[model samples]
Target: MGHRARSRTRRNCPSLQEQLVHTTFLEELVFWTVKFEFPQKMVCLLLIMLPDTDYKEALTQAFVLHYSRISMMLERSTDPDTLSNRVVHVSVQLFSNESLAFRMAENLNLLHVMVISLKYMMGKILIQNTLHDADKNFHYVVDCGRQVMKEHCYWPLVSDLNNVLSHRPVAVKFMSDDNLLEMWFTFLAMFQGMNVNQREMTQHVEYEPNTYYAAFSAELEASAYPMWALVSHLIDSSSIDLTKRVLTSCLIALQDWLDAINFTHPHMNDSMQVSFHLPLHRYFSVFMCQAIKHQGLSLQEILPPRDVLTLIMMHPLRVQCFHWFPTFILTITITIISSHLISSHRDMERMSGVTWATISLTPLGISDEFMQPGQRMRD
Candidate 1:
């Protein structure tokens, strides 16, 4: 009887309240599977709960149609609080297609979405470092986040992309520590669009701390242009000048975050007296590495400066050295990569002309020497 009921839910298009009720039951079943030491039960529960491709597509259309219906309902109401209550009460009583919970989510902020993601990380410092919705097991928060943002509002969110829009740091709305973390990661996500759209795939899992890699090699083929259109719209650039403005906006936003983070503030909490320190460069480089590794759509290709590119490429290798090799060995590793990139004139030809100039002008930061007259530039 229990299995038959579950099968019925699978075969039918459940109303919104019914879906949540079923989902809640499934969520509980997962907990019990773990409690009873049934690993396969846990995996089976998760897989079954996921909407298949056709269902996902159908659910997407329903979400947009529901949003329009909601707008009409809100507009007709004389008192919003009373209307919200009536709609919610009726929806629950009837098990209506419009769930009160989904309606309430549209008002949530980006920070709220990120906290959901953090919960799934199991209190680890590192995430699985993925951006695709297909990495559903790894990135559960994104689905919920999308629900909160709503597909209908995706365009509107794009218009307000930058929390900081200028270099002078004008007085802006105060954001809390958690908000700052969301902004940083979301910015990284935008930069890693290529990786999200095109990458080697990971697979369904029996357990997690899931595999970071898998065997599927068929290419995830798509351009980042439409997403780029949203970004270009964010900055209000003319179509011809879109690329330059987008890059400038990103660089400014990066600097803005770096300025906001209180370096002295103890960020990470642990049982021990010591807290894990996130290095200054790692924040930049982690996102940079994701962007750098894109073979299909190289963000690194358009961005200027050979020295910056050199540092971005070396970050992953440096991390490997730090983790897998000794400090002295890491030192030698950096020295070799840096020398080969900078010292060889023939090797420099692969970089743009502007990049070569930037490299030539950079003094390698080795000596405490004074700048030449008129050479010092504004920060």
Candidate 2:
């Protein structure tokens, strides 16, 4: 149904609380009036029970709209607890439906909102040497970490965003906007710095290893791998200038991530195994080659410089080079086509007095222009 018709259907349905009251059989079971103080709880229940109907679609739209609005408000929130709750609501809506996840990213604003939320939560948890009492701060740190993780939103936020960004056209639109693109790199920088602090904290903690910290730290890497991998899909489909820009940013981000992370950290290695299985190494290498071929960029003029290339190829998180035979063949094919076009252009320029004409007749049969042609015209 059209959005207007669907919105009208939603308005005609009972109020959210009434739908909950009717669906839950509260009228038959409760003798006294019962009010739901937490409307999100009721909305969650309604989402679960509502069958296939326009009402469900409307509710889904309402939830997505709510998520969009709240996400924008996250930056202004002062209460961490309130911010966490609002972030959790966004996470719930994102996980509830794939279409909702898509709608959240449709306008490309949610991506930046998510970055702000993640950075805020990470900043809270990464607070180190701020308090004099080590004992009190440890508990506080754990609580901050737990707040963002309450609904599996911590990892799923990055992972699901990667899933939603699987749409190339949407991704390109996102990457095209300078503000949104800057936000993406800013996220990478924030993630890198937060991870460095996390690793240091892991190394310095005096108490026994807390599984909660371990799980949270592990999920951090799980989130990181997907966020890094998210851009690989866009490289092949973008315009040459954009592809160059994206590849450059991606390399710089990867370099920053690799430089900051301690691979030997106990939790980090396995988390890498869990999330770093993406063939981004392969994607970047291949697309870099393709970009070079299309732009006729010499190795000396290639993006990221030769030294960075060496770093990427040698590092633990190095780009895995594969499909050599096909890539080789494709490069050769492109070279031949480029040569042929150059030679054809020269030949076209050498032809003197070459002109193109179309079949023509005027009001007077066979016009003077057509009759006077001895100008090497071809019709």
Candidate 3:
């Protein structure tokens, strides 16, 4: 009776289907082994869950998955633009574990694959950021209602990628079909990260109390966009496309900010920070210097026409910017002083110093109350 029961159990079990699927998977693995000539250890590590497997497989699997993912994402991103959040999660998960991420970054092949994936995801997120809700009629979900951007779009992926590059600078992947697309995508991604926005990022805010945060985002982008320092070290380009794009985006964003801040119809509330646009000329100086010193491109090629610069300088926005700085500081001095980084080869050091300076000056930037009578902030 026990033997009959055992026989019945064996017959009823779904081993036949499971074996067929398993066998097919193994056969495909063998085909990959033969076609790609992938290392046995690497293939085994990727295809199976083994005890104490080497991380190289994780890196390999990430690249393999990324290639397929990119193809899928590109196809779906047409017309209707179906950029799945799943791709974002999958891309980030590859680097979720700290140990594997660093290790994966160490390998050039893995790092290249990782960067390409991030470039797409970053660009995708940015499109949503720029065009949201009924504003542009996009199908993708807004990152979050409160923030101008979602954390996943910038943090850890872009931030950690920058970190990894700082430790070990890698080559640009050149994976995009054209160089212009490559530059624009990378620049936009890196731009999103130039300013660190939130606290702990993982925790969501119910709503940003001040709507200025949104305007401030564009304002901050305009201010910082001039220090397009990453362009020289990161891209392999002689084209004016990147420089043109940078100047154009910065100017347009600057205009948007100017319009937002200057217009009285909207009316700012009392809760808004008082000295938000103070020292705006300092960023304007940094942009000119950094662009001229890009090393890869000529000043004439990268910068707007002299007449254009003169026009911008004379604009109502630029004239109003002078009121923010000390009386001793003039518009020409703001544009003439230039960035120290323009002369030095150490882009990283310059950025670090600038970041530190920004941090140190934050408290000074805050105001408990407006100046008494005509007291100047530079005092």
RMSD of each: 20.1, 22.8, 17.1
Task: Give the candidate order by descending TM-score.
Answer: 2, 3, 1
lDDT for 376 (candidate 1): 17
Highest-scoring model, lDDT: 2
The alpha-carbon lDDT assigned to residue 80 of candidate 1 equals 38
lDDT digits (tens) for residues 154-225 of candidate 2: 453454456556555556655565445544554444322121122221233455323344333533443445
lDDT of 1 by residue, 1-379 (tens): 5345434433442221223232444345533432333344444444452347443333333332232233333333344344444333322321122232232233222222322222222122222323212233232112212221222222211222221111111101112122333333443332221112111123333343111111000000001212222232223212213333334444444343322331121121211111011122233322222233321224334443544444332323322422322232122123223433333455345343433332321222212232222221110
Which number leads on TM-score?
2
- Cα shift from native, residue 184, model 3 (Å): 2.6
**Model 2 Cα shift for residue 206 (angstroms):** 9.8
Given candidate 2, what's the lDDT at residue 147? 40
- Candidates 1 and 2 compared by TM-score, better number: 2
When 1 and 3 are scored with lDDT, the better candidate is 3
Show the lowest summed lDDT stretch of 10 residues, model 3: 264-273
lDDT for 316 (candidate 3): 21
lDDT of 3 by residue, 317-339 (tens): 22232244324322333443235
Clash list (residue pairs), candidate 3: none
Better of 1 and 3 by TM-score: 3
